[model samples]
Every structure is written in structure tokens, then in C-alpha cells.
Target: MTTVHGSSYRFIWFGLEMVSLFIHFTCLLPLLIGTPVTRAFMPRLNGATFLGPSNALSPVNVAHSRNRGIFCMRSNEMITVEGVSVVLLAGGVGKRMKADRPKQFIELLGKPVLLHSLEIFSTLPGVNRIVIVLDKSYRQEFSFLQEEDPRIVFADPGKERQDSVFNGFSQTLPDASVVCIHDSARPLVSQSAVLASLRDGSVHGAAVLGVPMKATVKESADGEFVLRTMNRSRLWEIQTPQVIKPDILSEAFALVTEKGLEVTDDVSMVEQVGRPVKLTMGEYTNIKLTTPEDIGVAEGFLRERAEGKL
Candidate 1:
């Protein structure tokens, strides 16, 4: 647990409110003035349109949908992902990196690697709360930072990744309608991509992001030889920020606990409980940092992004 001082805490909390209010009003003002302030870039292809707003989940028809091209954002765009809580899992020891501290505490560009995802989630209009799940040992190290943001709360992680998420989910507020679980290592996940998952998940019972499979895959009986070639067209490389309705998630998790099943990702639980999980468009730039080599790659990606080359 962490303690926040009186006036300083108030300032940080109040500052967050002021900033949130400013963004909320500023983004909405465009709609009142009748201007195209932004546009949602949906799927790329015309046929298997994963990028464009696939048919919305709402029974009521949505206006301003773009066809096979660009989707612009008007000033009065009200289709936003708000009042959701994100559980960022940073419980791993990251033995692969072999750092003195865990990978989450390691410095990336200027701030800690975990801060990269935290900063992005804090600014999104759709997200109201953020929960960080840390290993029991790391709690004391992370405690002081928790007081910096009023919207943030901490959770004691479990031994498994799923356990960490389950632990974090337990701490969410009763009013949180949407629940999002993401990896702390994937600092580059875009706000638009996350919003897309939330928007689509609101319609479908659950939604997740998956990159299309471009490389050939092989399934082997053992490490000795390759078995057969997999159909890449049907495969998608799964990624995080898996968003879903709170009740649906709760039900799925309940089933998981009852059956004593082990799931690597939240979607597996949803699937086991007979819920459909839809895939929305996600950026290819989203990468998970697991090893020392990945640090160089992430730095390069950040540099290219800064230079407008990515």
C-alpha cells in the first residue's frame, strides 16, 4: 500500500480532473461547432474489412461510417470508449532480460518501461481508471509511484499471468462497465487501437486485437522435424488490450475457476464459456519486449517513430 500527502495529493488529483475535463470539452466542442475534428481509420481491404468499423454491435444504425477508405472524425463524435478500467500486468521477473531490476522497472527512453504504457492509458478519454498488478516483491519498489496518479490503484499479482489479471480484476470498481487487460511490456499500443477494441467489444460481448499472420507456420510432432504447413490466412498473431463487458468477463472467469482450467489469455476463458470474441484492427508496431535484444528493437522503433519513419 502507498500513502499520498494532503495538498500534493489534492493537486495531482485535481490536475488530473482539470486535464480530463479540458480534453473532454475540447474534443466534444468540435461536434457542437460542426467540424470534422478526426476520423477513425478502419480496416484496409474492402472485402475482409478488419480496419473499417465492421458492422457495429448496436441494433441502431450508426452514421459517419466510411466505406473502403478513410473514416474521418467529426468534432461532435460521441462514439467514445469511456468509464473503463485497464489492468496492466507487470508481474513477471523478466528473467530473459537478466536485469538487476525487473524489466518493468528498467529505463526505456527516459522513464521506466512500464511508464510508457501508463502515460498513454492516462490520457485516453475512454479510460477512467488504471490498475497496475505487480509481483509481491516489487510492491514496495512501486509503492511511491502509485501516489503520483489518483486514478491508479495497485494489486498483488499471482504466480501466473492469468492470476495477475484475475487479482487485478478483483480490485476494479463496481461501476466499471468495461474491463481491459494489457501487458506492461507492450508500451507501443496505440490509443486508437485500444479504442477500437472497446468500441467493438461494446457491440460484440468481447473483443481483442490480433495481427494477421504473414509468415509461414509449421506444426511439429516433436523438435525433430516439421509436420505440415499451416494455412496462414486463417491465423492471426494475438496481441493485448483484450476488452470485454464486465459481466461477461466475470461469468467467464467463474467458469474458469469452477472447471480448474488454465488459460494463457482472457479470450480463452471467454471462449470456454461459450462467448464470441471478435478481433478488431490493431497496429503492427505493437511488440512485446521479452529479451535483451528486444530492447534495442524497441529503442529503434521509438526512434523511427520520432523521425516519422515508422
Candidate 2:
């Protein structure tokens, strides 16, 4: 037997301590870095898109889309978590709207259109933070929101919609597990749709609030000729309040940034990574405030809702 010096014993103990720390960190790094562990457990796209109807919590029928895949729930069981951060995109210049100000600033009822959606999320349960992507020019106009609700903060707008989304998402609370991205233009987005999207996003990693297509959708290859007619039953008119897990969304955005992909919606970012987004059924009433005529339509809807007619 060889006798070891005190220094040798001390050195051996230090090596053991280092090994323990290494093992511990290896196990914790994924959580610390917000790795999407659910990706491994989630169902993958096998050349087909899976869509869940907004009304049905279980798998009843299949809906197809040209954009991305959706996954049906195995059971009606829902998963709920706290710390939801809302990224409300209000950065558009509304050139098509042809208004004096941006459409979001346009009055709907007695207030700006943006306030309708903001008030919904501000009072919503489980929403820990609200990051509004607003241009610096209009920040002063909406300053009262920040004063009223500490959860509300403003993020600067970017060149594109995706860029604006990234800017807003960046301002989300560090503890936020889920992100619900909404369009300020769609002021009539019901609280039920928001909650459904949030719950489904929490369960499926991604969820889009949309209504079934009522009008017959036709595809045109050239500007004049109709190429093909799409099955209306199999289609959905996508809308906002597109909710997604922050980690999954972050990964998708990273890939989009790396590959220079252009996406119109936040769910498209997730789709690029071949992940499934649940189509939570939304209302036709949740219309985007695009043209000047939309303002009157939105006001009518608001009036109906106020009178409990809708």
C-alpha cells in the first residue's frame, strides 16, 4: 500500500468536486437555455398537416392547409401553465387603410382600436406581461396604458411584421413560458379565443386562432385565370392571437433568421421548423381592420356585443 500526502488527497477531492459540478450543469443546461424538450415527445410531420377544429377538443375530423402542419390531441386533456406574455403587434403604417393615422390608432367605439385588444389582455388572467410593438411616435399617445397597468410595456417596431414580432418577444418577461401574439387591428378578438389559443399553445407548443372559411376559396396561378378550387370544409381563415411556447418560438425564429425566411405570421415561424400548430377555432367577427370600411363594421360588432346580440 502506498501512503498519499495531504496535497494528493486534497487534489483528488477537488477533482471529484469538479466532476460533480460538471454532471450537475450538464443536466441543468437544457432548462437554463430554454431547450424545447417537448420537441422530442411531440409528434412529427410525416408529409401531412394535422388540424384541430376550434370547437372540438378531441380528434374528430381532419383539416388541411398549404402553410403548415397541425396535431390533434390524443385526449381531451388540457395542460395549463402560468406566466403568459402577450406580444401585441401594432407596428403597421396601414398604407392600404389610407387613414390619417395608423388603423390601430383609429377610433373604434370611444377609444383607439389598439385599446380594445390591450384592455382584453390587461384584464386577462395568467397574462403576466404585455409587450406592445408600437412606433416611438405613438408611444406618448398610449402612455396612459403603462401607467394603468404595470404589466404593459412598449417595444419599438421593426421593418417587417416578423421583425416587429421579434422585437416585442424580446421584451417578454424572463419567466414567461408561453407567448400570445395578437394583432392590434383585430380588436374584437374574444377572450375565449385568447384563452383557447393560450391553452392549446401550452399543450401543443403552437396554436393559431382562426375561423372556418365560409366563402369558396379559389386559387389563381395567373392574375386572370382560376387554377384550382380549394375544399372549403378543409380550409380555415387564419387569424391572430397566435400563441406559442417561448422556447419553441425562439427556436423557430432563430432558424428563420439563420435561413433568411420570410413569414407573415408567428405560427409560420414555428411551421418552418416542421412543428405542428393547433388551429383553435376563432370567430368571423375577429376581422382584421384593413380598409376604411372595416372601422364601421367593427363598431357595429362592438355595439351588438354591448347589447348582447352577438
Candidate 3:
């Protein structure tokens, strides 16, 4: 009996050793075979492919798992499958910007502000196409853009921001599973923030990129007097590239049409339908080109980025 017990222990130890060796082999196999490992990896989940680093996981990925329905937890970085489409909203006339053209048409860093955001999305993997929601009046000015990238297409702007998104969504291919909505005026969006928002959206049905409010808040019934002081801790200033599953966005839009509600942003549509949206942290440098003063700020940010200081 003593001999048999000793043999069993030895067998168990050998099995454990083999398991460790296999795990190590799997990790190093790409290097051993001289295959290049990309910055992103694709993981299969529930018949969908998720692109991200397979080795690391973040707590933020699991933050809404229980309460937000089905959540696919993965690393902070992720790309969707080849069916992702981006809607660049440039329909708004820059009344406040006081520019010669629309804010999006204004030049920043020697390129049009809209082009800066367009370049970012076009280069990302899994972004199959981008729909620029512009007025018919501006189409001739940007006609050369189509020659630059085959994935770009234009959609006519509607009366409101939500309408523009709806028009953009209609232009996406039938196979598109995910939709990313961004403001063309925000020319400084980083690749990291876009990826994080995409991953969060894929996992939690919807996601919005934003930064927490830095200043104390006040609520006013009238412009001159304050009604109450708002809670600064819970306040967040939202930014774009808001991402969502097409089905969820479609449902949100359906509700919007049924109720005739005017929405300021895309994620608010999900909220109206009682859906939760994950908030991904975005940089303060991703500012919208709202007024003339913002141009100087953007130029400085661009300089910092070029010098590797950002």
C-alpha cells in the first residue's frame, strides 16, 4: 500500500509539470516559429470574434457584467470584427465657431478638422467603412476624399444630430454589427480612447467615452440665478466616439421616432430605452473645435504629441 501511494504522487507531479510546459509552449510558439505577433489578438466568444490582448484583463471590463446583461470581459484594448462602421457627424454649421466654413471644414494642423478624425478611424482594423454625414452643399469640397479611401461614403445631414446618426446608420452595410459615432469637430481623438470605447461597447452593448467633471457644478432655473448646486462627483462631460451594437441603436432610434424626442448624443438614445452604457475614460486633450480660441489649444496639443509629451 505504501508503494502504491508513492507511485500515485509521482504520477500527479508529472501531470502538473506537463501542464506547465504546455502553457509556456502556447505563449512562446509564435516566437519560436518566427511568426509576427500583432499588437491585437482575436478571441472567439459566443460566435463573435473579439480583438484584444489575450494575456491581460482589466477590472473595468467586468464592471457591468452582472447589471448590464451579457458582458464579454477582456483586456482594455479591443477591435470588433470586420463589420464595424463609423458615422462621422459633421452636419452642424459652426454658428458659434464664427469660421469661414463649418467647424469640421476648418483647417487644423494643416488638414481639415474632419479629415483628422477620418484618418484615425479609417486606419483602425475591423472598421469596414465610414459614413460622413455632411450637407449636400459641402459634398463638392470633399469629393476628392472618396479617391483617397474606398471605404468612405457620404450621407445627407438631417434636421437634428440624432437624425444625422439615423441617416448615417442607414448608409452602413447590412452586415455591420457595430456602429461607432464620433464628432468630426473633435480632431484630437486618440487611438487608445477609441479602442477602449469599442471594447467596452462590444462587451456591454453600449459605451460612451468621457472625462469626469473637474469644476464645481451649479443648476440654474434662470440664466442669472442658481437654483441649486449640483454634485460634482457624479458629473461627467461626455465625448465621442460612442459605440453600440446595431440592434440596440436601432431599438433606441425606434423609441426616438415613437416619442419624437430630441437627443443631444447617441448614447442618450440607449438611456431612453432603459439600457446601461459603460463609460470609458478619455483624455482631456480630445476637445471639440467649438470656437476660435480652441484652435490655439489644439495646435499646442498637436505640438505636445509630436514631441512625445502627450
Q: TM-scores across all candidates?
A: 0.75, 0.76, 0.77
- Estimate, for each residue in 97-164, the C-alpha lDDT of model 2 and write its tens digit: 99999999999878999989898888765778999999999899889888988989999999999999
User: Which runs in model 1 stand beyond 4 Å of their true positions?
Assistant: 1-78
Total colliding residue pairs, candidate 2: 2
lDDT of each: 0.76, 0.82, 0.82
Candidate 3 structure quality by residue, lDDT tens digits, 49-137:
33434332222331212122223345544333446789999999989999888889888779888888898888776777899999998
Question: What is the Cα-based lDDT of residue 22 in candidate 2?
Answer: 95
Full ranking by TM-score: 3, 2, 1
Candidate 1 at residue 245, lDDT?
85
Clash pairs (backbone) in predicted model 3: none
Instruction: For residues 141-161, write the lDDT of model 1, one tens digit per residue.
Output: 767766877778889889787
Clashing pairs in 2: 50-70, 54-281
Which candidate, 2 or 3, would have the higher TM-score against the true structure?
3
